[model samples]
Target: NKIVLPVASSGIAALLLPGGRTAHSRFNIPIDLKATSTCHITPGTMLAELIEKAALIIWDEAPMTHMHAFEALDKSLRDILSLHDPKAKTLPFGGKTVLLGGDFRQILPVIPQGTRAEIVSASISHSYLWESCHKFTLQKNMRLSEDEKEFSNYVLRVGDGNPLPTEVNEFDEDEEDQLISIDRTLVEELSSDPHKQILEATYGRTDQWKGTK
Candidate 1:
């Protein structure tokens, strides 16, 4: 909240992003593009300055981000800060330190691409930002009971260093099969029945719809 919202006060380009909050309210995060969006295309926005001036972009829940998140941010940087070229379409936060809190051994990012959360940026890791990444484990059990911690630790031990284990899956496999499931009722009311199925078909897969699905 401090990092994201505070940047807004700086009057730089800001996007609250979709999801995370009331679906009807302002939590519908559009998309994150920090990785690829570079500073060669255009000048950063007024709000972008706050982020530029600030010492850090403390992303509290970074593990929950998607794979293309940085890519989207890259475009944002191009939109806010500088651009790669007058016509290029990419952006980068320009060395802005992303203070990623939260435990890597904890939950992962919100990936719409269906890629395993661990696969978000397999080549580059959180600590690899510069030199080496840092790891900090809470010394005491602040959120879990001793028993629960013991179980979680057991699971972590089972996997060893294979990959970060996943917490709750958010939705079951059945629900997943449904988000992409056709909205027959909406289609029936909005358009002719024959075209309804067709329209639904069209929405299942598109670059823009990629995140929604």
Candidate 2:
């Protein structure tokens, strides 16, 4: 296979990739930030070598990383590849094919005590690269069954902070600005033993402890 496919993520999610390759922080590669306008990877490292040879680079969990991380990589790639073809310096990702995938609903770039605006500011969308990005969406709820599709749709709507459909929920206009009320029975059960309830919810359903036990 001549095409190199290197998949990386911001964290341990890389272990879940097909071959379990290391996905260190974007900044883990040796770089010189001072020598150029943007960071450039130290020219002789394994990372630079692989990047030079790779046909495709897939970076997962894109939303969880800071915009600077992507900018750094873009800058480094362009600097490294431009040596062979000066025109490559003007292309995104140094004119190399790259796919970045993630959901914005998941964990965003973490900022200490950050207001909503600060957190959004640190995301990839806030980066200059976003202007060249082509977006795609998945309409089908593949993870759910035909019977559970209704619930899945409701969950997605809630995640997007969209108004729920009338069939799923109906609320008064006054209640819209306030927290929605939960069922009394569910509240009573949770109040009875909140700690145990949480523990069971997290670990009771799986064989996580069976081997040790």
Per-prediction TM-score, please? 0.40, 0.74
**lDDT by residue for model 1 over 156-183, one digit each (tens)?**
5543443333433677765543333222
Predicted candidate 2 versus true structure: per-residue lDDT over 1-213, tens digit per residue: 655554555447776666534334433543222212354357677767777888877777888877776787788788888988798899988988878877887889888899989999989999889998889886777788899876776667656767333332476766564443332333434558687667777678444656775
Clashing pairs in 2: none
Worst 10 residues of 2 by lDDT: 27-36
Local distance difference test values of all predictions, in order: 0.42, 0.69
- Give the best candidate by TM-score: 2
C-alpha lDDT of candidate 1 relative to the true structure: 0.42
Candidate 2's TM-score: 0.74
